[model samples]
Target: MASSLTKDSVHPGTPGTEKTFFGHPRGLATLFMTEMWERFSYYGMRALLPLYLVAPGGLHLTAGTATAIYSVYLSLVYLLTLPGGWVADRLLGPRKTVTVAGLIIMLGHLCLALPAAASFYVGLVLVAVGSGLLKANISTMVGHLYNGPKDARRDGGFTLFYIGINLGAFVAPLVIGTIGENVNWHFGFALAALGMALGLAQYLLGGRHLSEQSAVVPTPMTAQEKATTLRKGLIWLAIAVVFYGLVGFTGHFTLNWALIPLTLIGLIVPILVISRILRDKDLDGEERSKVRAYIWFFVAAAVFWMIYDQGGSTLSLFADASAKNTIFGWNFPVSWYQSVNPVMIMALAPVFAWLWLWLNRSGREPSTIVKFSSGLVLVGASFFLFLAPLSIAQDGHKAAAMWLVGIYFFQTVGELTLSPVGLSVTTKMAPKKYASQMMGVWFLAVTAGDSITALLSNPAIGGVNLDKMGFVALESVLAVLAGVAVWMYRGKVNKLMGDVR
Candidate 1:
């Protein structure tokens, strides 16, 4: 198996730049720091979004309404990932993509500083586009650090990257979320922009750390690349223009009403193309089967994110409304509860990493498919546990903060089982030609889950009580889906994983 191969790794500082750090490149530090700040900017904003929108000092949006906005934002963010990866893989490369995205996100944050409704909506769109450009590409650059596919450090590299994400998440809520909760909401947003600007500056200043992943992979006619690039650019421009125009028309920031369908189209077109890409005779059957399983991988991940993203959307609302959060007789802000999951993840990642290695050596680690199924069940069970307290906390009484902490605890454990494993699964399971694209697709499922969760969080959704519906609906749906998938594909999921174990 590719994962079975191992040796020293290298890191890239710039596209053509290469240097080694303990068998890897010094560039890893630069990229790692950059990703850390980027995540900080992103999560900092996420931790505050629902609160900002619903707070009286902010939008005064209802819990349901705020969640829908968040859902649309999440969906569009991942959907943009398709074009983001395509552009990076075929045009700009990872380093350049990261830089461009950083700048755009900074610009978005600056706009977010404004109090006008237009600025808030406009800022979020920019962030979404920027995230698409950055998220998957940066991780790919890490893979490029190793000269070979089977480098042992690959998982560690990803773990380092994951830490960067949580590192940002960890501190952002404390600073940005708290300020947004207490001060001018826009100030918190401005802080996020500042974080991105710093990340961009650090990345460019330390160009020596980047690897070869940024070099233009040689291609034929220049006009063809230009045409392909232009077509996609124009398509995105059209979507953006139409979307912004409606914000102008409505006096309300209702971008999702336009974005949701466009994103759906974006996701569908790629699945068809990815299928054709996998059929190339140059690929082997084992690779093809692995790729096929990735379809399920994407679907399975969708279920996971549906539960995972509630941290920002529904869970935030739950904290504000019903969570009984007090520590040593001190009451805490509801938004602070949002910080627990990342905290758990940050502390537990190393433990899980070691656990996986130990279990693998002992032949006790679950298969990838089995691990994912178990994760779904774990996450579903978390919801069921929450349900018990939820039923008791009705009538607008604030439930104890332990409820929120407990919710994050179980979900964090499930994420350990699934999210990280699923990410590695993408690289292991895809053809080289389609690795970036499949990663984008894997994220598309994330987008779908976020969007769906966001929509469900909306209080006015066809008269559905978001908190009432989301908790029960999420728990029931995921439980049934996980159970059925595990039962039905128990054999195939394992069979497709040829020698991966």
Candidate 2:
């Protein structure tokens, strides 16, 4: 909103004469279409996973197990970004890294299209790792496109990029979800794989347009450093093998095991990142405080995403089980409900973009912290809105479809306020040396939130009985409490940000 963010932290290259997409770099078009298709594949598969797991022809998992697996899958997708981001910065550049990851993602989706349990599990792992590799770097590359001190177009470019993300999301559920629910789930997965393939093809052909900065590792290691890194990597690989072997071999293959390790990592990674940033000998006090400020945003973002991401798990189940689906004798596939979010996002994104620009110009834009708190409040209120209609639903009667529509509307608004702003602020507040890693850390919040959403949706752990009035009420209260906490800390957090706004 402040209009001063630049691509220097990501690209650090001189502006070029290239003009291909919207009067910006030709690379923007490449990145835009690439991310668009990637998101389509990701969300298309996501819209089907939970339902597929519970379907008779599929895994036939219980609701708890289904949601749990979904949780781990989504969480790991973001969690692996920690290491993926490190790889991008220290070994492979974002370009090659994303390209390779995209290929893996395509293969992963194809694996899902196969009708085998082994393939399913393997596919999840591949996609998670591949998504981790691509997610953080792709975003950083977008930032790289407008690299300059005076680039006022940076935020607008990101806004346009964000719209592409929603565009993909908007179309996926309608197309893939409909096919998955109506045709066959595996076929649905194949469609997702095809989407990724298209994206990969485009990225390969268009690689020339990307900034040169994205093509080189930001911090190349010397031979000795590479040896040390390889040793550490092998050690970690061994550790992971042991962990996975134990988790897989044992009879205890519950989702809780998956959730526990990631939860611990989620907790620990932020502490280490913060400590690393604050302890940097290169950073002065102001920069150190800025890193500290980022931690607050990080936590608030996790809270928001945990609640918002329920749309894929708990809310998807609700759409199938509780919501009314009929419209003039046409029954909507439960998965189609997933489209409501991106549809609202597509319609309202421009309005939000305009609002932010207008507010920034008027010097009336809220600080990032307040905007985050506002998002928390709005998301919390959405859950409360669910209570009224759901609480009064007669036996055998589904809740009105408008309830979900309303819920997603509010969620989208909250998303507009917090998500784009969060990305902008993360780039702004991050120390230049740690920019890529910080982006991964920001995604870690999403990992934590998504994992938390799954954990809470587990009826055994959180006793999530959507049929009862208490569950929604409890979540509403917790969100409001989180919002209040953010509100109370707003002034302190702003001070820590040190003129970043």
Candidate with the greatest TM-score versus the true structure:
2
lDDT of 1 by residue, 1-501 (tens): 111222344443223333343334556667767887888788888888888888888888777667777877888888878777777777776678778999999998888889987888899999999999887777776666654445555555566557667877888888888788777688889999989988888788866656655544422237777898689989999988997888778887554555446445544654665677677887788788877766776777777887777767777787777776679997766667767877888899878777776776787967677778877877787777677557767755667777768878988888887777776767667677665666677788777676666555444445244557455756656665775687479687667767664
Which runs in model 1 stand beyond 4 Å of their true positions? 1-26, 216-221, 228-256, 259-286, 455-463, 469-477, 480-484
* lDDT, residue 95, model 1: 71
Instruction: List TM-score per model, in order.
Output: 0.87, 0.91
**How does each model score on lDDT?**
0.72, 0.80
lDDT of 2 at 18: 34
For candidate 2, write residues 325-353 as lDDT tens digits: 87776788888888888888878877777
What's the true lDDT of residue 39 in model 1?
80
| lDDT comparing candidate 2 with the true structure | 0.80
